[model samples]
Target: MENNSIWVGKLKKLEPSDYTMSILPKLRIHEENVMEFLRLSASKPEHITEILKMENNSILIGKVNNLIFSDYAVGILPRLGIHGENEMEELGLLAEHFEYISEILRMENNSIRVGKMRSLVLGEHAVEIFPKLKICEEGGIEEFFMVTDNPENITEIFRTENKNISVWIRKAKKLRLENCAMQIFHNLKFQKENVIAEICLSADCPYHITEMFKMENKSIQIGKVKRLELNCYAI
Candidate 1:
């Protein structure tokens, strides 16, 4: 009998004890019935893990992995609970967080650009990856943190969705902030040739502001800035 011909009404009769390879994969299971589906497929833990690798199924994967590691043929499924655990460890394959994560948040080396990743902490190596990463209207890097010296890198990171981004510059060779809106520069050792934007230099802005304006008569275009706050000692 072909499994596909079987009605969805008959799914209740299917049991883990039956142990039929063909039936499990063909059945269209729902999230509510995932426990039964996992049990029916427990003979092959690899299959379950592979599905997990492809889908971001949530805390249920972690619980199932624990059961599999304990040598249970098919662990009993209690009422669905939010364990708040994302990481899973069966044969020690899951990572805390990897560079690339699609919907499933697993380690993938194919593409450096993150697909549906939400919270990712990019280190010094991020500058190289950001340029190649595509900025789309859909899922993108929500929160980004990096310490880089190059102003171009800073610009690149902000080019994408600029929601929650923090950048620390050791020093900028060329500081250009024209037409920048609502940007706060804090405790920066800046050396530039021009400042033509309508900006507000407040607090610790140098008393020797004239030195910063020693331009070479070259119009270094910094676009338009609505307001710029220089946070330093009293001016």
Candidate 2:
């Protein structure tokens, strides 16, 4: 909504408050909202350019299909909550055309692809979209947390990087990791005896499974026992 008055012109000048009901909904726009329209219209370059210009040439992010991996997108990625230039470099390696990203990662509508993503921040309802995320590699999602049942979903608590990874899946019934390769963990312990063990034993890249179930059975269970499953390789 940068310089919103320019877009609305006379309408915004005439009826400032009513413009929201008259125009914003048709454009599906709200200030401080994640520019999802960029994702939807990424395929059309002209439309993308037009939208970007309309938004005062804001950053490009979120499944920007078919567009070039230009400096514009790279510069704005950080604003979209994407961490690290290394992660953007990995994204650049995916394909020349950004559209190939969706095909390569098997992305679905509203699904998040965490492949090569170093940091992951999720809310309480995150587990609903867990199946949608394409997680690959050992340290793909190194930082993650699901705080209290409230909306104050913060990621700064107990976050360790590079040397060791700490994840707090509070009240998360099922936690699963797949296709982890070349992992090195100094302290890996399974917190509970009842925790399921389904890890690959790679002598070259040794790692351990640590599952902590702190919540009561009734609180965490989704009609089943709380479990942590990792289908890892070379870990």
Q: Best by TM-score, which number?
A: 2
Residue 43 displacement (Å), model 1: 34
lDDT score of residue 65 within candidate 2: 16
Instruction: Tell me model 1's lDDT, rounded to 2 decimals.
Output: 0.28
Instruction: Give per-residue CA lDDT, model 1, range 1-235, as digits (tens).
Output: 5323443432323343223433433344333332311333233444343233332222232122221111111211111121233211211111112221122222222222223323333322233233333223243333332322223333433443432222222121222221111122332322354322333333223332333344444333333444444434312
Query: How well does candidate 2 score on lDDT at residue 60?
Result: 22
Question: Which candidate comes out best when scored by lDDT?
Answer: 1
Badly placed stretches (over 4 Å) of model 1 are 1-123, 137-146, 149-218, 231-235
What is each predicted model's overall lDDT from 0 to 1?
0.28, 0.27
